[model samples]
Target: MRYIAIDVGSTFLKAAQLDVQYLAITNMESIRMPEPLPNENPLVKEWNAIQLLELMQGLIDRQLASCPGCKGIWISTQMHGFIITDEYGVAVTPYISWQDERGLEYADKLGSSYFSALMERVGEEAWRRTGLWEKPGVAAVGLFHMLQQADSGMEIEWEGQGTACPVSMNDIQTLGSKRLCTLGGYLIQSLTGSHVCHFTNAAPTGLVDVRAGEWDIDIVRAVGCQALQFPRIVVGTDIVGHYHSRWGAIPVYPDIGDHQASVLGSLADATNEAIVNMGTAGWISRVSDAYHIGEWELRPYFEGSYLPTITKLPGGRNMAVLVRFIADVGQSIYGTALTEDTLWERLLAEADRAAQYFKTGKGQSSNGQLHVHVGFYGKQTVADKGAIDNIDSDNLQVGGLFAAAMEEIAAIYERNLYVLATAGEAIEQITFTGGVIMKNAFLRDAIAKAVGIEAVMAPACDEVFHGLLRLALVSEGLYASVHETREVLLQAIL
Candidate 1:
């Protein structure tokens, strides 16, 4: 059997043709996500809903053409972003991105940000029900921002219209009639007329009672979006609807969260191994058979399991700061425009050389003399800026600098892993995935050494696709359960 797997990622849109019987991805394709629509508020990031849908349709159509007789369509999407749709299932607003930060804007006379106000109203208990932290860019916060604007009689500018009309009070009153759809849910609705959300995807919305497996009405009311419509929550393998395509009607599954999909695809031993995925952003996660909440973020996983995760760590985005600095210096001082690939190659090569030099007891013995904190984008508690400490003349080279940065990131993983360990979820090994860790062998080794454990790369770079493929197989009844499918596939691949 064959299936089409799609990933609506934050930076890119990807699709693949999966041969379930052979456990192979016969073909895969990706395209950069469309540029966000211009907004007056720089913090507000959004995309044209219809345009994004059309782009995805083109990508899926190409995949279907290349691989005929596709039996099903499975999807995984970036979490915490959504669009508001009218009663007829047509989008009324832009597709607000997960990167959107309008929720941080001041919402009222009390000098409270939309996010802060919503957090205060929801309180700790209601917040805990969603298994999420109080943060901006989440769907609930975004909805609250809209609600506050409507309540204040303030016009919410989208796509940069100066004299935009204020969102009417009636719009707020009629919110229950409107549908809140994530990108994946919107796609499913557009393709198969299904209005459903998978638990994995829904958990990040800050509106669901994750343990209860439903939207929390109290939390919804607290956010002043009690009238807003939410989709039906489904489990991992539920078939939401069928997409009628040129090939035929293909079984369509509700989109799961990309993070969950990537971890699932890694084929890590859920009981004894954790997965560290470092892409544009990074996270260290371990699977659990039951729900347990603590300092770490809790997300719903397949087969009623849970994932204890430390998310939003520094990754490629942080690494890019140094890379861009080097590139800028080269262009400004030497008038040389370095290609991105060349820059990365040189950086990694230098980092590798530095590692080898240190291992062999180099001349200066400047080990631990330099440190790079990779928190360019603030961490969970404070908006701490990135810093470099203990830099000396002997260790102030590109190789040393990059190596220190890699070591710092590895240390972060180790520290967070200890958090999981303290919570009684210790792992003996790690399955690493994502572009950053996969491309840099030195970084992977650094992580392994830092964590004091064996580390292995995922069998495939496109872990989300593999994860969706596994889910598809289970949905088709080829596998008795996700756990069984993972064991069988892991053995086959290894």
Candidate 2:
């Protein structure tokens, strides 16, 4: 069987074709978005979504035309990129990336009690957890929690759009201007043709009933939308649908955001097992048999079959941030796209960019490197409120400061891993995936030393995609369970 995996990450988007039976990649390519699009451009927003969807279909046609339709085409995308849309699936608002900090007000509304309760059950989301603690680049898991608080009557207000938009984590959805439907479930619909959240997707939405493993009405109202409209939850392995015929009519398998899928694909979502995937971005997650809520956070996710709660580390886009800062040091002699990469040739080119960036910033060495923090998942912030500026040259330094900043990032990972390992109370090996592992030797060595665990890379970079195929084989009943699928994968690929 062949599986086409599309990874829609916070940074670059990628598509791949894998031969599950042979454990081979017949084809793979990174989906490219035209650069220089402004934040609020409607054309940029709507067209990007639609065009990318089409391109994904096209890739399937190109790669699998000879093999007939694939068993499943999986989408492992970024989570909480809350984009509103009309009935036809046209985007109503620009895509709000996982990095956006615009929802801090919602964090304030979550109230001490709710957050306290959540902490006792699960950890807080990354958007603000590190501010109280001071970590960088971690994902903001609290976004869902905060959004929920804003929607509920237990309301509080903070400055937003001049006055405030109401503290409602009940992420609203509309079927055109009719306002006939609304819910946290619209996120996946806006991206794929599907109009539902996956089983794992719901857990992180701060809307799933942790105990019941089902959607919660109260939580749905909190995001300010009806729960019914969201995509119906399905196991990560279930067959969702087939790609529209325009692209190639491949089968579509919607899923838990990329993070959870990575945990499974890497075989890290297991008792005392873990993995850190450092791609164009980075993240950390642990798989337990059941959910455990620690004192400082709420249970972010609870799969019926697994208890895999994750924290987005601060390493992903920061690589690009550093790469640009490095480039700004001098004239990029060759226009080679070396912001971040591991391809032998690409790395050498990026090195030249870094060299130039370093030389130019020598005098302004005090420009000082910036540290990106994480809370498993991070939404980084600084101690001082007014001490911030846009992430251009002023805020992101690259000299002696850069070295200092890298040290801080390394420390943040090591320290947080210690806290989480202790907080969760049981853990062992930490695995790694994504692009960063092969790209940055220094980072790999540093992380290995910091966590005090031997890190293993996915034998194949396309593990996530092939892993999807494994899930399809199970969900489609070709095999009885993940273990059986694993046995075949090990025999064929490993």
Candidate 3:
């Protein structure tokens, strides 16, 4: 059997054809995400809802044309952001991105930010209920910001002026009766007319009760969006509906969270293996049958399992900071302007040369006693900033700098792994996924040495597609459960 998988991500819209029998993905493609609509306020990140839908349709049409007789369609989407749709599932507002930070703006005369006010209204219990930390970009917070604007009869544009504008007043008021869903949910509604979302995607909205697998009414009311219609939450690979493509009516599954999909695709043994995914951002996660919340965020995974994950760790984005700095220095001092690929190649080479100094038994002089903290974009708390300590003339070059940076990133992962261990989750091995880890051998080796565990890379880079294939197997009843499907797929890959 063949399946089509699509991952609607923040940076790119990716798709692939999954051959179930071989457990292989073929004909993979991706298109850059549609640029956010031009906004006067830099804080606002949004896209044209209709345009995004049209782009998705175009991609689907192309896939169907290339690979005829596709049996089913699986979807994974970026979490948190949402669009407000009318009663008929037609969008009434722009697709607000998870990167949107308008919620940080002050919402009251007393100068409480929308996020702070929403948290104040909802209380700390909401975090325990949702299994999410408070963030300005959460959908609930954005909804609250809109509610405040509508109630006050003012549409506060995110411009620094704080002047009232009535432009979005109608759209804001319409939210009281409209439906809310992620971009993937909106696509499913458009494709099959099903107003449903899987729990994996719903949990990120800060509205769903992660344990109950349903919307928390108390939290919803507290956010002042009690009247907004939320989609029916589904679990596993339940077929939401069928999309009538040119090839045939393909079974469509409710969208799953991209994080869950990628981890599932990694084929990590739930009992003993933890997955580390490093892309633009990073996450270290392990699957569990029971729910536990503490420092780690708990997300619903497939087949009644929960993922205790440490999210928003510095990854390639942080590495890029060091890379750009090196590149700028080279250009300014030596008049050498290196391309991005060239810069990475040189950086990796430098890291490789510095790796010998990082080996055990080496003295501080071997590595110039450099220690780098890579929390450039804060982890856990946004107030955190990165720092470099013990930098000396000997280790001030690119080789020592990048090596220290990679070491710091690896150390961060190791520290989080210890946190998981303290929580009684015994992780025997680590499985690495995502482009950053896959491409950078130096970083991967550094992480392995730090974690001191049996580490392996995932078999495929396109984990979301492979994960969707696993879902398809269970959904089609080819296997009884996700575990059975995983065993079969692993055997095939091996």
Candidate 4:
């Protein structure tokens, strides 16, 4: 059987034809994501939800037309994005990207005392119910920001003025615009006319009970949201809807979380394998049969299993930030403007050369080299700020500084892995995924050395899409369960 696997990434919308029986990808295609709307605040980002939905539908339709043997459509999308919709399932606001940081501003205006109290209460309640700690990137924070805007009587407009009128909070409440749907859920709503999300997508929203696999009404109320302010939760393998094609109706499975999907797609034995995927953000996630709330973030896995993930904001984007900063400094010092593309290549080459120096014990001179702290994730407070320390005139060069940044990232991974170790989860192997980590040998080796494990690249780079196919296969009864399908496919490949 052939399954159409679609991955809605932050940068690209990808689709592939997967031969489930042979575990092969016969064909694939990708298109860039719709251009995000510009905003005054550098931290804020939004996408045209309707445009993305229409584009995705077109892609699915084309694939189903070409692949007559396609049995189902499986979607895996980036987690934490959300869009509010009215009774007719039309978007009322722009789709907020996971990288957005308006939540911090909302929390700040609420005052430190009130904000801290609310965060503490919310975090405790969320952790207890959802096995997830309240964090900035979660949708609950975005929802809080929206509610705050609503309380101020601000007009919330969807992308493209005159495309849709600005919606007021009272209007949203009266028009039944309560639920915050994921990009996948929105697609499902557009495709099957249902406003529901899979457990994997809902797990990261800070609203669903991880163990119970249902929306927690208390968390919603604590965030000043109505009980129905979240989508109905379904399992990963549930057939949420069907797409009627010329070939016939293609069964569609509930969308899976990109993080969970990537891990499953990349790791042959997800139960024993740990992965560090570095893209816009980097995360270290390890699967466990039981749910344990540690310092790390927790996400729901297939079959009621849980993963403890440590998400760090300083990933590929941090490298880009450092490169840009160095470029600016160079332009100021030498009166020469360097192209970003050229500077990026130059910085990477320098970083690799300096990493070689560090490996040979040349960069460190007993006092230790500089430490670069990248805090591209959280608030701008000093406590959450980034810094470069212990720098001397000799080591102030790009090579050394970039090398330090790389080491700092690896050190973070090691530290987070130590947390999982302390929690009694033994990771048998470290698998690397994501374009940044997989292609960069210096960073990959640095991570392996820092984590004290041999980092093995996953079998495929597009593991997120692969994971959705696995879910789809299970949904179609090609395998008795996800575990069996994963094991069978892994056994065949390995």
Candidate 5:
């Protein structure tokens, strides 16, 4: 059998045709990210919907025309965006991406007490923060706090400044998720005339009701969103429906936010294996039956959600800042822009330097017990004018600093993983995925040594897309369970 998968991303739309039996990509194509609205709000849009629709339709048609074996079109859209609709289900707002920082105000006012309470209740750290970081892929609670501050009569910057919020004074209702948790449903309706943002995506929203597994009045009250305006929240793998104007009417499974699907898709086995996605960003989380919230001060995750037991560090995403900092020198010294391909080359070169650093420290044993956690979020890792702070060249030269950063990152990963492993989620093995892994061999090795597990490199590393495809197939029972899906997946890969 064959399947076609589509991933609508921030910078591009990736589409591929895979032969399920062999688990091979028969054909694949990518469309450069279309121009977005360029709005300051980032979450809201300026793109002309008609133009977007036409472009997407053309892209799909072109791909289908070229790939004869295309079985179906499965899509995973940009996460953390919302497409609200009216009573008749017409889109009321443009997509609001997680990329949008509009909610920072609200995240701030979240007040430590409220945040702590929620973390205790939901059992995840991605929602809130503790120890200077939260779980990977978690939106910044600062955004929500910022929103709250603005609402309470502070300076507010929004898409429609004078425009009122969708929430109301008497708005007391239950909500399963907040923020961009519902993008998939909007895309489904636009194409298939329906709404379907599944639970996987919804779970990340601070507003999700982990207790009830559905939106609740208390959540809406807390987060202040229009929960009722959304379509019903579906299961991550539920086959929402099908379309067959001859595009091959395969099931329209509601893919969860790509990350969650990765968790379900990359488990090494039923009991112990875990995976880390080191893409544009990096996340190291293990699959577990229990939730592990960090200490009260570490205040991670909000109430009423169940996901990532703990998070490792904040420096993974900082790689980009480091690159941008090096860009001036790259253009002048290295003579290469920090594009994806070139970035990988630079990172790989840095990895060699890291290996050298490790070699120098090897045999030190006790003296080699150095640790660091690289965080790119505060600004870029390097000191630029707008950057939070430039790396201290006095102690942190390019090569040595890279080594130190990796070491710090490794230390944080070890701390979080071991803390949980000792507590209960004894992660026996681990796999690595995402864009960062494409070149940063040192990181993979460092992580492996730090954790002391035989790290597995999933043959296909695009976790979100691959995970979505597997999720749909498994959810349909086309494969028996996650285990069966893995078997078929391994075969298809072979």
Candidate 6:
């Protein structure tokens, strides 16, 4: 048997055909996400739900045309984004991108005192169900922003300001209210006509009860949702629906979150290994059944388990800033601009040379003081401009600066890992992924050195794609669970 695994990403919709029995990728393809409307509001980000669904249909058509034996469709989607749909599953509003921040403004409008008081009242209940705090960009906050706008007679625009559509307000306040679901839930409903979501996908929305796999209606009502709708929460292995094509009827599994799917796809053993995915955003996660509520995010994993995750934004974004700085310097000095790739190549070479110089006792090291804090969301400090301290003439070059940045990143990872260790979740092995870490071998070594752990590169494949495939297999009853299939499949591939 075979399966078509799809990853609905923010920038692209990726699809792959895999032979489940042999655990091999037969083919893969990607379609760039449909561009959003140009708007004056930088906070507004929206995508066309109808167009995305059409793209998915086209990709599925192409896959089935070539590989006629595929039996299942499993999806892993970008979480937090949401859409409002009519009863027939047609989109009534544009898909709200997770990047949208109008919800943050709405959150601020609640006033700190009132917000804190409300959190105190609903904090335990919300976290008990959702396994997440009231993050500004999640779906629940977005919904609040939408409903409050409708109530206040403000135009319902994506991310607070854009091209106004009073029609959306009418649909929203219609006598029989429409439904709201995350991007994954929207797709599942569109495809299978089922209002369903997986617990892993629902946990991030700030509306689900993580343990019960159901929406907390009281919390929903508290958010000013008079008649808000939620998809039925399902487990990872349940066959939620089926798609009938000319080839055959293929079972469809509920969608999973890209982060959780990436962890599974990274093939880390849950008992001892922690997965570190470094991309445009960075996340470090480990799986366990025990749910410890803290500053870190607690997400639903497979089989009613939980994953403790620490997310950071300083991965590729910080590296990009450094590369651009070097590129600008080269442009000014050499009278020619350097491309990002070329600058990184030069940076990696320089990093190697600097490492050798330090090894030979000819260069200075930061001694852990020169920290480059990447404050994408003000997690560290809103006013903190990242600094480089204790600099000397011997280590003032770009190579030293770049190396110091890597060390700082490594140090942050080490600190978080140490905290997890204190909490009795000691990481025995580290697996690394992300364009920055995967391309730069020295960065991986630096992380391994700083964290005091041996780091291995994640499988050089689309981890989310493979992760969803394993879930599809489990849904087909080929294995007892996602974790079991993950172990057996990873052992075979590794």
Give the Å error, residue 53, model 5. 5.7
Each candidate: what lDDT?
A: 0.82, 0.49, 0.82, 0.75, 0.52, 0.72
Report each candidate's C-alpha RMSD, comma-separated, in the order given.
Answer: 2.7, 8.8, 3.5, 3.2, 7.0, 3.5
Residue-level lDDT tens digits of model 4 in 341-419:
6786788799888877877988776557778887755642122567888877566778888888888887777777777
Residues 47-91, candidate 1, lDDT per residue (tens digit)? 888778888878788888877777878888999998777767677
Residue 422, candidate 3: C-alpha displacement in angstroms: 3.6
Q: Could you give candidate 3's per-residue lDDT for residues 1-494 as a string of tens digits? A: 77888889777898888887777888888999978877887778878787788888787778888877788788898898888887777777778877888888875562798888888888997668898878877788888878887788886542221122123545667655688878889999989988899898899999989999999998899888888888999876778999987688988889999999999899988888889999878889888888888788888998788888888777788898888888888899999998998889988998777766656435356535678877776333321578888876566666778888888888888888877664446789999999888999988998899989989999767888888888887776788887888778888877
Off by over 4 Å in 6: 34-36, 106-109, 112-121, 157-170, 246-248, 328-339, 359-361, 365-371, 380-396, 423-425
What tens-digit string does per-residue lDDT give for candidate 2 at 304-341?
A: 54433334455645555645655554346655443333
Q: Which stretches of candidate 3 lie over 4 Å from their true place?
A: 156-167, 330-336, 357-368, 378-383
Best candidate per TM-score, number? 1
Local lDDT at 52 for model 5: 46
Predicted structure 2: lDDT: 0.49
For candidate 3, the per-residue lDDT at 449 reads 91
Q: Kindly list the per-residue Cα lDDT of model 5 for residues 1-494, writing each as its tens digit.
A: 66667666656667766555555555667777656555654333433333444455566666677766555666666544554344443433444455544432223345443334344344444333222233212332322333344366654332331132342211112222332325556555555655666665555544554434565445344444544454567744556776454555545556456656555456345356556666555556554444444431121121222344443234445565665666777788877666766765766686566557557864133334233334545322221122222333233445554655665566566666666455345677877766666557777788789888788887666666666566546544577655467666766655
TM-score winner, 1 or 5: 1
Pairs that collide, model 6: 129-208, 129-209, 129-210
Runs of candidate 1 with Cα error greater than 4 angstroms are 160-173, 358-368, 380-383
- Candidate 6 residue lDDT tens string, 1-494: 78887888766788898687787776799888888755676666777667777788788778888877777788788887888887888777888876666654534455653334345556665655676645556776666667766776766444322233223565676625577777888877877888988777877877777767778777777676657666787864667887777778777778889998888888887877878778766778888888677656778888767888776446777677777777777788888886778778888888778767777875745452234555534443121356666765456777777776777777777777766554335788899875567887887887788888778988756888778767766766788777688677767777
- Model 5 Cα shift for residue 369 (angstroms): 12
Error of 5 at 275 (Å): 1.2
Sorting all predicted structures by TM-score, with the top scorer first, yields 1, 3, 4, 6, 5, 2
| Ten residues in sequence with the least summed lDDT for candidate 3 | 158-167
What's the TM for model 4? 0.89
